[model samples]
Structure formats: structure tokens, C-alpha cells
Target: MDSHVFQAVAAAAAALLLFLTYHSLAFVAGKKLPKGTRLPPGPPGKPFVGNLFDIPPEHSWLKFKQWSDLYGPLFRLNIAGRENYVVSSEKIANDLLRERGNLYSSREQLPAAAELLGDNLRPLFLPYGSLWRRTRKLMHQLTMPSAATTYQPTQVLESTRLLDDLIRAPQDYQKWFARYSSSVIFRLGFGKTMQDEDVLRRIMDVNHSLERVASPGSYLVDTFPSLMHLPDALAPFKRELKQLHEAELGLFRELLDDVKKQMDQNVAPHCWERTFIEQQESYDLTTDQGAYVIGTLFEAGSGTTTAALQSFVLAMVHHPEWMSKIQQEVDEVVGTSRLPEFEDMPSLPTVRAVIKETMRWRPVTAGGLPHQLVKDDVYNGFFLPAGTNIHPNQWAIHREPSLYPDPEVFNPDRWLDPSFPTFKEPLTVHPNIQNYSCFGFGRRICPGQNIAERSLNILVARIAWACDISKAKDEHGNYVDVPLYDYVSGFNTHPKPFQFYLKARSPHHAIIVRSALEKETQSDPLAGK
Candidate 1:
């Protein structure tokens, strides 16, 4: 496939390098008679291999940023005949992916993740077409900013439970954060909490596999489409990934059947799945298609929220002073009488700023999803040929010094202080992550972003109010250093396991957490904000 990301496989060994391709093949898009216009400037690469060795297996964003620094935001790379354009400037991204979305909303075919493991039905990977439009239209009612509010009752309840989880099991805060995110999305999609150990394990296993396999050059077939044309006997990646696909689809079918039975018996809780299933015929989706959409929804929310929340914790360890400031604001606004609610979100600017910063500081989709341009286009007198893969480069765009000063520092004031370029007139609207490049660009942006922000908001606020996150201590009681930018490398990257101390700010705060959980469990879980 003419690809979208780094050819990381070549970076592993005396593998093919990309520098040899730069001299004659850099900007022409295979020479279709575009004589005058030149493609975006980029690093020179090897012949045939085309920047393969130059692109690292993990943290390719850093390399992209380095090139962005040299090439001034619009740069190009060719990996084994694939044309890749990394757009580090938010303005260029908006001009192309958003404003010209008609020609740029499609995604390159990810042979491994989108085809073999996903059966080519996953909405996230689908190119812009009838199927994608149908799925997006079906989900429009459920995922919009206004609609996400309906799930606040569940979000509030689980976020309260999240506070309890941190207070009781600080060592396992990551898992609790995972659970909180999973339960919220699971309930919204399937009308049940995520309690089945086997199901959770399988979900996580598939997520990890996708992250690895979906990477640009992880599989040879993804990097070189010709390899995919061979028979299954010749292509081991196909055979193995097919089995993995069966296991994943089986999981989706199981969850769909469970929801169906509950609906048949009139016992199902209120959820998007119940609505979706009842109208599947009208939505014109096959059984498999319906399942894929719902499963994608759940998968998107769970892992991303987990990663972002974990980043919040990591940020606190890096910069504890902001933690203190946010806690003070939460205390004054939320008070000790009850857990923080979504209503308090308006009053807590520091909390919002922290969440936004956490996302900007270490975006989950670090490399940003690849958007394929469908037609030739010119931007700022620079040519971008059709079939060019564009990456918004979240890691670089968020670090744009014009918008975020001292980008390396994990500072929340950049969002609050008006002197900063990123500051908006009204604090309420400026820090929103709705259209942030970290989420995605234009029509391909994440549909579940509203729900994601709400989860981060409540959970981050409650944790800030109830617990103090600090550097962990070793056996001898010395501080354990938490690396600032060290993260697991994948399509959706997160901080690696780190040591951190989490506990209630005071005994009274711990009581408030328990009491809040008890009251929520006893009362209507869907009560108003």
C-alpha cells in the first residue's frame, strides 16, 4: 500500500534505508507531468527504500518534529514508494485536512489493522465513502457534544468510584483509571459494566495487537502492498492476522448477542447499543457492521481515556506545583461536602487547563492518525499530489512555540494566562479539546471527543480534590524519578509504568469519597448533575 507512516521495520537492521530515493523521486509524485509545481521540501532518502532507516520504529514523532524544525512544518518523506507528508503546523493541517476535507478526509488502507485484524469494517480505518458516512450518521445522535451530556450520570458515578479506587489502591491506579474509562464507555455502548475478567483481557489484548500492527511499518505487507498480493501460504502475516481477526470479531459478536438478549427480555439498561440494534435495518448496516461500529466506540473511549488520565498523573509527578494550585481551586469550588460534579467544571479553570495540558503535553495519538489526500492540491504555492499521506504531527503541532511557550515544560498557565498565544478571550471556550489536532483534523476527527473530555474532566478534578499525587519512594525511602517523556511506543502511546504516590489529602477527604460512592450506588445512578 502507498502508506501513511514510518517504515519502522527497516530501522531495525541492515534493512532498507530511505535516503537513496530523494535525488530523483522526492517531490514529483511518480512524475505525472506536474513540471512546474514542486512538492513540499523533505529530507533526502535512499533509493527504493525511501527514508525507511531514517524513520525510527518508535517515537517517530520526534524525528518528524526535527524535520519539521528544519523544513518549516510542511515536509515530505517517501518510504518504499509511499508518499508521506508530515504537516507540523496546525494552520497547514486545517487548510488541507479540514478546509479541503472533500479531497483529504480518506485514510490509507492499513493492510494489517484495517484489513486482516479488522476485516476492513472498522470505521476508524475506513476511507471516506458510503460505509463511513453511514456509520458516522448512525452515531451522530449519540456522540455529539450535546448528546454526551446524557451520560454524565454514569460518568459522575464512575468518576466517584475512580476516586475510591485511587484512595484504596494507589499502586494500581492505572488499572482503576482503565476500569473507570472502560465502565463508562461499556455502559454507554452495551448497558453493562466491564466486570468479566476474560472479556477485559481479550479487549486489552486486541488493543495492544492493533497498536503494534497498525503502526506504519510494523508489518512488511503494510509497507509494501505487493507483498499482500501473494498467497496466504507465502504471506504469514496474513494467515496469523486472520486468526487474530476471528478472535476479535468473535468478541464483538459475543457482546452484541448479550445486548440483543437483554433487549429481547426488556432487561437491558439504557445504552446506545439498544438504540442502534433496534434501528439497524434503517441504518442499513449488516449485523457485523453494527457490531464493528459499537465495538470501535468502546475501544476508542477506553484506551484513550486511560492514556490521558495516566498522563495527568505523570504531569503531576513532573510538576507538582500545578497540582497544588488545582487542588486549591477544586477545594474552594467543590468543597468537602460532596464529590465534584460536571457543573463545577465551569468554575474550575485550573482543572480544565490541566486536562487540556495533559492532552497537549502527551497526546494519546502521538503521531496523529494519517489522512490520505484524494486529489492534487497546492498550498502556499507548494504542490501536494494526490495519494499523498498527511500526518498532522500532534507532538510537533502542540509544541509550536508561537502557541505554547516553553513547550517542554508541563505548564497549565499557557491556557489561562492571556499573554500566551493559545489563550482565548473566554476561559470557558478556549481550552476545549473538541477540535484539537490531538483528537484529529476535520471530518476525520474523533466523534467521541466530547465524552472523552468529560471523563477526563471529572476524574482529574476528583483526583485533584481528594488525593495528592507525588513521586514514589523506593524501599529505602528515596524519591523515584519518573521520566518526563518516556512512553510505550505504539499508535496510541502512553506513559510507561511509573512509580507514584497517591493518597487522600486528608482523612475527611477519604470519608467524602466513600460517602459519595455509597450515596451514588444507593440512589439513582442516572440522576441529574
Candidate 2:
């Protein structure tokens, strides 16, 4: 950790990366263009590195948006020699990523996430093809709208402890949120709760490493993929990745084997693992692939769900006015007697709007998952050659000034009130978060979208119904400030450590919350079945 030596090494690495980039640029961009077509205009980058230096060290999304404003909404950012097209306009994103998805459904090779960490088996990292299709189909069948409803009882049951955790240990609300999400995914994937502290820590660690590794520029190998070809003996850089990959797969195998043992005893609970085990042959999957499919589902849901819940808390603390409005709306729909249930979801428009607005306000994957073109394409006289990397930058797409007026402000009215341009009629249908751009676009939309939405719905509703959240206070009774942008960077992001306050709405609410946990064993009808 010598600062001077670290800086020197980093500078040298940057120089090397830049040196190889121009050569890559020559290979990728040297192809002939279609007649009467050209690439989209963008901010001019320097000779070799292109926009490498133009991008700042952190929050590159802001710089991308700034470029989108300077250039058109659909423009390119050439990093080193890579042809990255950033689509800020929702229309353009839909047109390219949705309407013409056939050609744009593939993904660029990711060194860390796709290859090193997952062996390209993780659904999120799988390119658009047969294996990707089979996995996506299986997950969709498990997590689709109607199918997602099957897990609501588990979501509701797990959330009882979440509410109790909030009432008792509000200072560790983030940990509780993490626990709630991880526990739900564990229950669904392996038919067990996340009570073992060490196992929970390992699951959390794997996901954090996943978010970190999946980030673009996390490894220079992603920039210069040749680094991935080094001999196993000489590739010291891959040691951690290899270990992480094995550890993750090992965790999945261990859990799946446990399920099999229970299955042999005829005591296994209903879970995705069991289901995959029963039907793996039909899907043409091996034993390991089955485990990975279930594990990938858990990996997809655990952290992002926690991040969404954390963002909800952040939104509540930062904008108490909107929070108050949601409280009032929830109070009117489901009185002060019991916790809000999924049945009340339809009537709680403001609550749903706040959740939608919360995600829009702060997307988990701010940078967005990069999509690759499988064939040459043209849009509006722009010749985007094959192999171009397209980023429907979630951060920029969510902040399109035309769609989200005063986008920086956390105003739920944009989704709730009729006058706002983003508002839609039939409050029951319009403000849905499942189809939001943040989830994704085209064939690559998040398979866990249904489950994430359901989890958020129940959790947000119950928390709003049972407790009040606000800024934490010191012994002197002074309120602390919550930083809006104090968020973790990477593909999947969440708030950095900050102070917050949580309390039951009243003694009655506290009683209900505590009593709910008291019935933990029999409370879930799905339990012990």
C-alpha cells in the first residue's frame, strides 16, 4: 500500500493500456463504411487513447450525460479504440435495443465477470444465443409475473423480521435490508433461511465481488482482452478471479447437494433448485449448470434488491415531503390496525410511485450493462459497424430532461400527478417499474425483474405502513445530513454508509411488528410443507 509506488504502477499501466488501444482501434474501425453513412458524432478524443483521459475517475455517467447534452442524445464515446455508443434518449434506446434487438442482443466479452468469475454461465454475462436463451427461458418461467406471485408469501414472511429489525436495530438498517434480500433469495433458491452468519457473509461477499468485478474497467483485460490469454502459471492477475469463481460455484454446488440429500429423504422443500434438479434433463443441463442457474438467480436478486431497498430509505430520508405523502396515501388505504399486504398494492398508487421514482432517482446500475452488435447497422445515416459496444446508459436514460423535468429533484409527482409529462392514466397500470429502462431493454431485460418488483412492493408498503424513517439525530438532538450521491460505484450500486433513523409509527405498530416475528415458524403457510 505504498502510495508513491502504487501511483507509479497505475500510471505505467495506463500508458500501456493506451498504447495497445490505438492498435485495437485500427483493427475495429479500419473496416469500410456503408455508402453515404458515417458514425454518430461525439466529443473529440485525442489521437491514441481517444476519450480515455476525458472520462473522470468516478461517476462517468455524469460525463456521458454531459456529452449527450453537447452531442446529440445518440452519440458515441471512443475510449482508447473502442466504439461505445451511448443512447441517452429513451426513444433511441428503445429503437436500437428494443425494436432492432436481433442484431444488438449480443454482449462484448467481459474478462472478469463473464469469463473469469462465471465461466460465461451466469445469465447476466451470457451472450445472446442458445445457452443464453435456454437459461433466460428457465428463469423467466420461474420469475414471470404469475410465477412471481408464488413467492409473495416468502417475501411477506421474511419482511416480518425486516420490520422487527427496523424497530429494534434501526441503526443497522442497511444490514437488515441486506439480510432480508439475501434471506429471501436463499429461501427461494435453497429452501433455507440465511441464519448462519458465516454463510450469509460469504453470499454477501460473493455478490459484492460480482458487482465490483462486473464493472467496466475493473480489469485491464477487459480493455485489452489479450491479457486473458496468458498462461495459467504466469497469470497472477487471475488468481483472485479463479478463486472467486470456484468459491461461488462451490457454494452453489454445496447448496444444491444439500437439496438433493433432502430430496432423497423426501423432505426437500419446494425451491428453484429442486425444480431445476427435477427438470434438468428436459432442459439439457448438467448437474453443475443446474446449480449455476439457481445460483445466478440468487446472485441477481440479492444485492440489487438490497440496493433498491437502501435507495428507498435514502429517498425517504432525503425527501421527507414525498415520504409524508406516501405515508398519508398508505394510511388512507390500509388503516392503522395491521401491516399492509400485497392485496393493498393496487390501491397504494403513491407508494408505488415513490418506489418507481426512487429507482429512477438513483439507478443501481448507473453505468448500465454493455450490449454488443452482432452485425453492421445504420440508424439515421449513422453507420454503426458490427462489434460496436452500445450502452443504453441507465443513468443517462433515466435522466432524459425531456421525459423527467427537473430530473435532479426527487419528485414522485412526476409519476403520480396527472399534469406531469411522465405520468400515465389508470394509476393501477402506469407507473410500473418492471418495464423501466433501469431493469434493461430488449431480450436482456432482468429475469429477476418480477421478483425484485414484488420484493420492493411488499417491503416498501410494509415499512411505510409500520414505521417512519428520517434523518438520524445526535445526542444534542441535531439532525444529520444524508448525501444524495454517496453511492457505491460499479454496475450494481447502493448508498455508502450514512446515518438514518427508523421507528414504529406508534406502540401499536411496534406490537404488530414484534408479534409478526413471534409467529415466524407457522406464520408462513409455505413453511414445513
Highest TM-score: which candidate? 2
**What ranges in model 1 sit over 4 Å off?**
1-36, 524-529
* Model 2 ranges off by over 4 Å: 1-22, 525-529
Write candidate 1's Cα lDDT for 1-529 as tens digits: 3232223432422232233334335555457645576767899977777787899988999999999999889998988777899999888889988899999999999788888889888898999899999999877777987789999998988998888888998889779988999989988998877778888899888788878888867897777665565657546789899998998899989989988998889877778888888898889999998888888888889999999998989999988999999999998997888788899888888899999998998999989999999988888867777888999999999999888889988888888998888887577566777777888999998889999989998888888889998898999999998888889998898998998988899999999889888888889544331
Distance from true location, Cα of 379 in model 1, Å: 1.3
**Against the true structure, candidate 1 has what lDDT?**
0.85
Q: Against the correct fold, how does model 2 do in TM-score?
A: 0.94
- In the range 431-521, model 2's lDDT, one tens digit per residue, is 7786789898988888899999889988998898898888988899999878888887877888998888888889999998887777765
- Alpha-carbon RMSD, each predicted model: 5.3, 3.6
Alpha carbon lDDT of residue 411, candidate 1? 84
